[model samples]
Target chain A: MFGTYLRRELLGRRRQTIIIAIGMALAIALVIIVNSVATGVRDAQAQVLRSVYGVGTDITITRPVTPPSGTDQGGQGARGPRFDFGAGAGDASGDGSRTVHSSRLTVGFGTQTMAATSLTTVQKVHGVEAASAVLSLTNTTFDGTLPSFGSRQQGGAGATPAPSGGSDAKGGSSFDVDSFTVMGMTPGGRAVGPLSATTLAKGRTLAASDEGKHVAVLDSSYAKSKSIGVGDTLSIGGTDFTVVGTVSPTGSDSATASNVYIPLDVAQKLSSQTGKVSTIYVQAESASAVDSLKASLQKALPKATVATQADLAANVSGSLGSAGQLVSNLGTWLSVIVLAAAFLIAILFTISGVTRRTREFGTLKAIGWSNRRVVGQVAGESVLQGLVGGIAGIAIGLIGVLVVNVVSPTLTGGLSSGRGVAGSMAEGARRTFGGGTGQTGRFGGAFGGASSGARSAAATQVDLSAPVTAWVIALAVALAVLGGLLAGAIGGWRASRLRPAEALRSVQ
Target chain B: MYRLKNVTKRYDAKGRTVTALNDVTLEIPDGQLVAIQGPTGGGKSTLLQMLGALDRPTSGTVELGDASLGTLADSRLTGIRGTEIGFVFQGFNLIPTLTALENVETALVPLGVSADERRDRAARALESVGLGDRGDHRPAELSGGQQQRVAIARALVKEPNVLLADEPTGNLDEDTRDEIMDLLEGLWRDRGLTLVIVTHDSAVARRAQRRLHIKAGKVKELA
Candidate 1:
């Protein structure tokens, strides 16, 4: 009887049911779309972090970038790689005139060195599953010609040679400096290191057997740009290393952490920083233990900066950050307002329905229907009405999600390991070189050069997709039903309060 | 059986107190067909409300069989109305959305009757009221006479002990009114049911076994 009566009522009064259902449907659909988009944006942020920090690295420890005190910037000595050519180090193929090539290695941009023993400290922390240390360095090769002059007889580095070799008669000489990032890693600890998020695109990755060997791996993009591949030799800090492999980052349009990768021992020895590491990547045994482990590591090494994946995600900038803000703020509020309006509409319409049915309810009450029975019928009708809306909303939501995914918008993100020291590095260089023929002056890099902090920022483009999961659909249905139940409860209460005698008399 | 002792009902209309039923005392036997006649606002409907257990008296007792109506809780009164008393309004108070058969089945809803039994009983009741063929028609599709028959079937579908009719033929023409009265007379005779009718028509009152008149919330017996 309840079903029959409710069906007849809904079919008989089409306008009311249609209005309520449409209202609820639109609200539920909005909720689903907004939630899915928000989740998609968050996932994009995670991808950006993964591209920078490597996969499976839950926490990263680095030394904070402190302000420069006096000549040293970022609290580090020397802003960039310094090539110390001794009195007899220059090639002597000619009398007081010759070609000279010198290479030097220093800490990479946007990074600061910490004691290599910090990796051991991190490993000893409870809940730490694995730890790997990396020494990020910048390799700069300076190729220049010494003019043929009599300056070698007077002094050293700044001597003006005679215009006799590799220079015009006017004593004009040109020098070129080329630089790229190098990361030193444990050959066997790729599970939570700089190479974790990369897939070998050519040849083979660094093996444990090559730990102390002068072997290197190249980033696929860098390798392609330089036209260098496996079996090719490259120079780092004046040492020749055979490129054994090329790898690419897993994220789309993202760059690997460094241009070149070499064994930690060799990188340390050639760079003349044998016991120094710039970053330590740590992985906890379980995801839930990451925060606690980070806290303990931070306490153990108070001077070091410990950051989790969430903290890193906040550092992501560019258009992707804007999208995240839009989703978190506008999308959330708009959906909330629409859903509230939908619930309000449902409540009002149901109340009006009960008001219209006063006479009918009174008649039922007078005949033999209990108040409870009549209220149940009203509630039942509303619930069915809400269910209809929920089904329609799910269909509409699915279509909306499909359209969003098909149109996958591209977002550009910029991820940096730490704050850049380029401005300070440039200032420090001017103070040191006094605007003379500085090796890192012209081709410093995109952001001048973070010679002091060595901050490196990589820009990546990602396609955003709103994924609709089963749980999100379930929530939409639950919300629709909840809206219906709320309206029904209020409407039924109104119906139950009607006095049968007054209702019948009012009809007259 | 019905009994009313000093039953009084009052209402406050726009802040002015108005007494609809004043100290009305009455007794009605089982299987009696009674008619009540009165002018507007003369407490005729109020008296029916008390007799039907649709209301509680302000100052007196209304009894049916062995139970007192005024002192019982609303839930208890609802039980009595569902199982013992049925009301037929002049407006043919059938749910407009329901078919004549479903309208009749509503009377058995509070009885917790199974769907099959409710359907079977409603069909038989409609057949008895001469609306068996029109059972599928909604109230809007049915004529005034047919709608009234559906209302009548609904009222009697539960086989209640008392049937209260408020101006049952008020909306009908002379011929249709006569037809409805004849049906009610036949049903009352065949079922040996207690029937009460409130109307302004002297002709309809003339056919009842007993007649009462009300003037200014006061009731007077007529011979």
Candidate 2:
């Protein structure tokens, strides 16, 4: 009977019902779109950090003591105030014997002040797989001529002397180029800090032999500006260096903006600072090993602050992420507005529905139908409207996301790139575990399977991908149901309060 | 069987104690067709509303069978209204959203009737109202008289012991009103329902087994 009543109400009030449905659909869609984008950003950042910079260590250690005062550190300051890295600090676990240390990136800036010796000791800690020392130099620009491939470039002034050479004599003016953050690393560090070799745009990465060779690998952005290809020599900070490789464009604001990599030894030599490194990158066997290892390292060297890969990523990307969150926050507020609009629309539709059917309700009450049943009939109609509207709104919202992505590619920062990763993980997990295949068989099949497997492998290659589509779908459905229930409650309450006798009376 | 003793209904509308019923005392025996006749605002509808348990009397006792109407909670009163009394209104108050048949089926929903049985019974009621072929029509599609008949059918579908109608033929023309009146009289006689109708039409009042005249919230027997 309820079903029959619901059907009749919907059929009888087509226009009003459709309007309510549309409102619900839009609200659900907004929620889905916002959630999807937020999830996308989080996944994308993790991927670029991991794939481009390998599964970084579970825990990292730096100087236990603050860099002695008066040390002039250059480049961007650590995100937070430099903590006192003094040794012998007590651990949070109240074990007075345990000490904590900072990561290399968190250590004081500048070539001379970074405590490389203190970081190297982490390698001696138990459960330590590998540790590589890194020096991050900021605000350093490469002043060189970029050779354009067009006729316009050919007609312009050719390659000129670099600005730091003290001769603007070549008509190539020093543009005060934007500085990219340069990180110095050794080839052995690549095992723990993996950079996919296939993504190298040009030349080769630094080899172990290239330690003091004054060789550097630049991101595609820097490489493009300097017009310096593999085997090309460029002067940086008064030191001549060979451009041995170029990293593929990751499109991350930080990665694309100013990143360059060079051998630690060579960078130290070029900067005239020997036996000194800026920060150290360490990796543990698993995430679980982090806290214990951090404790041991802190106990061993108390002046340093220890952080996990996720922690460092968050700190480095926090400002950027916060900015993104602001956008998402705005989106959230917009969604709230949409919800308010939905409520208003629901009210209007419901009021109109009630007013239009006043006599009908009166008639129902007159025919031995209780107020509860009459209310149910009215509310059932509202719920039907909400369901249809919610679903439709979600569909439109998804399309909107896609349209925005296409129209402004840079707006979303390649969220679409991560979709492949999500799909492949499911397939890979299914094929490996569901097919009764052992580790060896799974590995073998993954490498040797047919074209489909290759496709799967390609799909699975995302650095960090976790599927959140199910979450999005669930949230949408839940919103729809909630909206429907709310509408029903209000409509039912109004229906129940109608006075049958008054409703049947004719107006004067 | 029904009994009313000194039933009084007062409304405090905008701070005025308007009496819609005053010191009304009456007994309605079983299986009787009675009409409460009055002009506009003469308290006939108020009396019927009180009788149907739709409203509480300001003071007094109303007994339907052995149960007291004044003491029941709202929900309980609703249950009583659904089971024991069926009402037909002047507007033919058919749920516009429902078809002629489904409108009748709504009366059986609270009865916990099975879907098939509910449909069968609703169909039977619609057929009895001379709308068997129009079962699928919504109230909007039916004439005012036909709609009133649908309302009558819905009320009778529950086979209530008492059938109350307020201006059951108010919206219909004379010919249609006569036809509806004939149907109501036939149903009352055949089903032995304790029927009470509130109407301004003297012709309708004359057909009842007993007629009572009401004026200014008071009732008197029209010799």
- The best candidate by TM-score is 1
Model 1 DockQ, alpha carbons vs. true complex: 0.60
lDDT by residue (tens digit), candidate 2, A15-110: 777878878777777777766666655665555344333455465443323233554343222221222423334232221122232211221121
Proportion of native contacts kept per candidate: 0.72, 0.51
**Overall local distance difference test of candidate 1:** 0.80
Q: Please name the candidate that would achieve the greatest lDDT relative to the true structure.
A: 1
- Local lDDT at B24 for model 1: 88
lDDT of 2 by residue, B1-223 (tens): 8899999989889988899999999999999998999888889888888878777888999989898888887677778877999988776666777788888888888788899999999999989999999999988899998898888888999999999988888778999999999999999989999999988898888898899988889999876
The TM-score between candidate 2 and the true structure equals: 0.70
Deviating ranges (above 4 Å) for candidate 1: A68-70, A73-104, A140-179, A250-254, A416-457, B11-18
Across residues B92-172, which tens digit of lDDT does each residue of candidate 1 receive? 888999999999999998899899999999999999989889889999999888888899899899898888999999989
Distance from true location, Cα of A496 in model 1, Å:
1.9
Q: After superposition, how far is residue B108 of candidate 1 from its true place, in Å?
A: 2.0
In model 2 chain A, the worst 10-residue window by lDDT is: A432-441
What is every candidate's alpha-carbon RMSD to the true fold? 6.3, 15.5
